[model samples]
Target: MMKIYLALALWMIIAEHELMSGAELICKRRINAEYRASVLMSPGYPFAYPNNMRCEWVIQAPEGQQVEIIFLEILTESCCDTIELRDGNTSSAGLLARYRGNVSESIYVSTFGSLYIKFTTDDSFVFNGFMAQFRTATTKTQNCTVKLDASDEPQLLTSPGWPYGYENNLLCTWTITAPEGRVVSITFVEFETESCCDYVLVRHGKSMRSSMYELGGLLKRPFTDVSTGPIIQVIFRSDSSLSTSGFKIQYKAVKRTKTDLMEIPKKDKCTGKIEIPEAGHGTLTTPGYPEKHENNMNCVWVLVAPPGMRVSLWFTSINTEACCDFIKIRDGETPTSKKLGILSGHSTKFAHYKSSGNVMRVDFQSDVTKVYSGFRAVYEVLNDSSEEKCGGDLRAAINRRQYISSPNWPNNARSLYCAWNITADEGYSVLFKIIGFHTFRRRDSIQFFDGESAIPFASLRRNTQHDDESFYSQSSNMYVIFRPDVTTVQGGFRGYFVAVPKRQRNTTPSILVSNLLGQHGRDNR
Candidate 1:
């Protein structure tokens, strides 16, 4: 079969550090495929060793379908000669990825870092899922990251008590390995389930019926099983510290017949737009109402304020899920004019699970104010992680905190370093990039928008593909940053980074650059 490559970048806007330390936004993107192949991060050009990268691919054939997974020789087999696929200390296998530097031995991280596999049509395979997290390049090295516990024999079985939403565990005649002398202390750390207030168990070299432990353990830690029942597992870790080191697990009934696990049928795919109101009825004026996406994205009702009145746009998604998707709202010119609100992946990054309207108030003076209009927020949705990210409902906790900065610049950077204008306890945030941005190179002062005017803090990302089709070549690389609080700041506050993506080379000829004006005011505010 011919190979078609698919590259997806989960672009998110990050606010300044108002949150935690050592926390970097881990952007994760997943795709379900039937087979596995070599998937690693390449740093564009050459680098010392490889671009210290990690990739995960689902390989085992799902139950019901006998299938075979295939990998493109062009990408994987070529480098197979020099690359390592599994952990170093352990007997190697070309089927899995190798664990090199930065991989902690205490956790399955070394094995989880990067993985590759090949499937055959004769072997059953089903869906393929991918994960992309805006995680720190640094690995987690702690004695308590992954916990495991077991007697001797281990077995693979399903138990509703498995932590991290899983209902299965491996109890069997499994083997355990650790980093050097850490093995004895690295038994089964602990297993806690998101479902209940208790812990579950899995025995080694046994079956589901035998892998049992009581709920509620005094100490919880990371763990791993070597081999249990039919499923052979060398490494297993939870989303949030399930198991780290080498834990065995036998294969489950998730296997399928090679023939049944065919390509995803197009008929079952997601179709046209979902009929939902952009803004749930949180609060609205007689003139200003929620934006709905029914008619060709037709946004009705312009700047209609009864004499002297201030409009409060309360979003219902403020506490619900409508906020996970994307929508648009505009005023003054056409609905297509400068977008008043264009939510980015930041919405999902925010620890706020409240679905609908997080408020955006605007005071229009006699309807003559430039942005004399309101907006309907378009949302960004979720795949793997849920609304309870970094921390949930951050806005509702703190309100009205703003901070600015003075930062480092002289480098070949696109954005300036501005100190974050944030308050310790306030529902506030640092603005990264505003939508409706007008990049002017001709003049020093750039207009934030081309038309009448737009609102502030209204989320936006450059449509480089459509904006400066010539200058902004890498629309994929360019993204915005948004920090709700210093606590939400994952790693150390590295300050806001402005990136201008470079395009691939010109094979023949592309679009021409138009003379554009310059905008002097940067977000270094």
Candidate 2:
């Protein structure tokens, strides 16, 4: 029986060599000799494979048997050329392994009746391809857990079926070790999985109690984390149902220096109450300001100014998931405080706000689906004075118009800095008409913004006459800023605003009422 088996293997090798010498550019074959080991090779075994070549091979075992494959050599372009192994007969089956670059000898066992192998090359570089041997085994073995030692060069780690979704009911773990006096760092390049039923748990040490992160859901951007020590363990788990494209990670060993051992500065908690310094200025940032924030976070921050002073906040940057996350600002310290604005999505420009009283509250909430880099803001305490008293929150009525003007408008107003927020009812937009416009030709300006964004949509400056010129808001709010040089005194601008349906005609005439009685009559009707 041994002699016959050896002869059959020799015959298979001769046949494969003859086939390789043929003119076919693409090669495919199947092997079902359950009792004899068979060799699999790329289109050109010891030589460089041709560019744009694709080859496939299927090895099948009899009932109650499993297929095992051992790699003898693999050399290909780092990322552009590749080899893939699946557990079943088709490409859609659960992935067993993927290889690129020069890999050491490795072994893989199929969980099903057959194993599928595919080799593909791009149009660019080519290299000496892979060679493996496969045979059938009577016992089944799971090849899920893997241990790796980190080196100066980075290494790639991926889920069982990365790029393609992983299989269900999987419990895979990877333990990475770095040399003494060094630490391990892992960066997630792509991440997506079942939000509720799949998770990747990372631990700084070998034990579960040392877990540093339990990550799931979808990450919109790449982020890196360093382990506390020289060892880290990552575990991936999935339930019996739905799956998604799993995660891809790159890891390397980095030396720990003196700076790493020094005491690090403390960061503010995710939820806290802060008091502004006597200097009346400070800054605040989301938990992971420069990096992607975590999923499913609800953080709140309250800022208290000195007695009799109000808080003015400026957001330098803001980026969050557009649909399921928000940063809400309020006028007071409590959740029930009057809302100022709800900001979300990537901010194209900076945003600024001021509270009516001494306290302001900020609330940030994120859902479990996706995450992005959050916001950064600064605050200052401002006392009520001539320069700070011109701007206030204004609500527009459907029938009556509200008017706003620069400080001491129609007069020589000087040293003024003012801002106004105009809001209309839901489903309505603010209509602003400049009834009077006059300012120093080159020393004063009035700017208009569409919503909470700081990017101005329009501006009046340089003695430009804007009387009877009108603008409309894209949403229920509009922001305006009026500023004049402290050295120049000039006649400022005036504007009237009213709430109108979004679909209303821009040519619609403004409704002007003279007295409170007429306004009340219109409101009552």
Candidate 3:
């Protein structure tokens, strides 16, 4: 009886092995029309799959029919074990989708007669593998594709499975048609999707070739666009991983006239040229700044600094309709110059932009739609010669030295606000040493920042004196600022900087002096 029991146990083990091996073999084959509907699974499926695996399968439908795959269950090591779906019968076919990790129920359809699937695993952790089924389906049977016709009333469109989050591995197309002599216009009400893998594409005509715009990510405000012709196509695609709440849009057909196509002049409240005074600083604001700006605005402000100086601009407050309103900055006097940046959205954090020459142009444009509190920016002129100025953009090189000092340093420096931005190449750090420093202990201050951050990492105030102090930056950039109260003035500060290899940085204060002396000695010799 014991021998019989042992034999039964051995047979059971053999049966389990056979099942596992059979599943592996089944995963690496080609299915034909003989099997109109079938299942594909990872080896040892419903259990943790083995590590280090590369399996492939091809599901082929009859001619004129496409293949559709439905994933009923999916679980794998996130990002390490992956499944790739292709549109043809071979590995080199156009990739349809790729998936990893614990994916929810999803579906994929092929554009042709065959669908190829590949599963790969790295030599690490494992998890319960996936189970999917494939079947043949015609294009008309697809539920996600739809067509709409023009009407006096607008039509509202939404992503499939809206609000509940869309399924993965989806390619949904929506085509809108207008009557003869009319065009289509679409206004997005809400748009949010998996930014990296899900997007909505807009095209001008019935075919997919005349591309108009592709939009993704979370939309902060409403967006509107008009089609050029009587037909428009919108396509939304999501890959085989994450999903989001999707989008909602209202589309309508409109008759176009000559007046609608022509550009009309907009009345703006603020548009002019700003000249920096001798103090080398000035401020600019949008129309009704600190409050909602007026719509249909087309404002321009050209800032001119004194000759031989550059313009450094910083925004203290910014809020606007993120979609249709903008503040565009150019690096020179006219719109044809290189664009520095386009500011939109809402942000209270301070950011800095500098021009290459003495002129910077700012243009503000708002569509006829929404409005929000506008922006306020301050501009300062930076002297080009370091010997005659207290602040400028400084670059440090290996084994080389650079110096910065207060305006008319070694003399009593008065009311001033100056800044110096020091940077070094990657894999290196900046070493700053104070050769001479003296400031009012109560009112005057000097700040040191590790990067472009608004907060300073170190500071000196309250009658501080550091004749031979050193500071090391954590990264490749450092920012220094000096601000003195108007009441009293003292001998300001002087500092020299050098770039040091991050791997061999010396933090000792005395080494800075020795290094500087050694460089000076080399220069003298």
Candidate 4:
């Protein structure tokens, strides 16, 4: 029998000083506590491991269940240092995997009752280690592909065996067709997959060879699409290597009425110009505030807060014809000011927008057809406090530092959708450091961007409970956004932002090193 080396966290806690510095932990202390769900990391995660270390672990699941393992990150000596997975409790069992180099993927296998993992490293250099998660699942699984036709009813589609890494070398497809004179809509609730390599391909018609229309990408963002005709097909493919959380989509068919098909004349009731008072806040609605808006209309709203105070807009509801009839928000009074973001589709959990100055403009345009319940938004004047309210925009002083927190933070907080635009003088950059963080897993996120863009340079979401290290900006402007789900609120996040002179950023690290050396000298004396 192969020797089982168990290096657990709780054991290290009990004997921290006695444990060797290069030793790695293979499993957790309690079998029952970690049996259901747990994440496993290579010996020293987020850090490189020492040379000449060998580790082995045997994972045993409940009878009649299989074990699934997912590698979050894997980097090591490509040929020498390797990690292997076997299907039995011993080395003599069938080898399920032997991996090295830059390999990151997920695996699912049945070892009858236990799965054996072995890691070997020679006396040589090292790199950042691996991290993985292991869980249990039933032997019976869903098919790789599914088909649906002649159905107008709503249905749900998920990646084969979701909430787990999908199987390797798999292709799954879903087809939906409306009864007659109806339209099909596919709304992806959440989608995360390996871009290009493993993806979900969408077609406007019935088959893989459909030429009417085709739309497919890695679907990293939440998306919803309405087919141009009655038939729609979706294909999901996964290679033999890496996999992701996959996706869950909702599909339905809507019957087309006469009003939905024909172009309605523009109504003048809510299609005229509107302006809010200079004192500060008010609400605005589309042509029909609570009802489906009219087509072929144009509306504009100008918000003027006090001269020094900026304006903030929050969209409480947003449902347009997505891309076709859309709302545009700008930071200034003119049509050429910084365009904040084009609003379309369903409202996101976080829908807060802010102006860089006291003046902001909003323009809404609808095509001749296809309209949904229009948007309802409200604007407020931002105060002068360094600590602004949650869900509004905030700016940091060029030479000073400030703190930001979620609404009711360090305690149960409200569903928060907030943004902070930290800016500095022309030769400066911004530095952000997380003080603390806690939120509902998988449904909330705090993202950081280099400029006024939607794509984030880095983000902190749930499941990563560590105090985030500080982030230094390459530019003078930085944007931070916080979005939390509606239910199951938790103690939210707090962080500090400071502006640093770009010229001094390089020397700042040396200054810290000298300070550390001085402290060590004093200790030695």
Top candidate on TM-score is 3
Cα TM-score of candidate 4 = 0.28
Candidate 2, which segments miss by more than 4 Å at Cα?
1-141, 146-158, 161-165, 185-197, 214-225, 243-254, 258-525
The predicted structure with the larger lDDT, 3 or 4, is 3
Clashes of 1: 162
Model 1 TM-score is 0.19
Clash count (model 4, backbone only)? 0
lDDT for each candidate structure = 0.24, 0.73, 0.74, 0.65
- Which should have the higher TM-score, number 1 or number 3? 3
Model 3's TM-score against the true structure: 0.36
Worst 10 residues of 3 by lDDT: 516-525
Model 1: lowest-lDDT 10 consecutive positions? 403-412
Best by lDDT: 3
lDDT of 3 by residue, 1-525 (tens): 999999999999998789767767776888873346677778887888877788998888888666778788888865357898876788866555667777777666665578889999876669999998777642342587899987768989999888789887677778899988889889889999987657776777743235345678899999987787888877777766798999999999898766545254455458888887544345678866678887778898888888877886766567887655778888998766776777777863335577888899998887655788888776666533335476789899898666677876645576678888999999888888765566654467777787777776566663544445677777899898888777644557666799997734434345444544543344331
- lDDT for model 2 comes to 0.73
Ranking by lDDT: 3, 2, 4, 1
Looking at model 4, the pairs that clash are: none
CA shift of 309, model 1, Å: 28
Tens-place lDDT digits, model 1, residues 10-90: 111122131111111121123232333323232121222122233222322233221121121112111111223222122
Model 3's C-alpha root-mean-square deviation from the true structure amounts to: 20.3
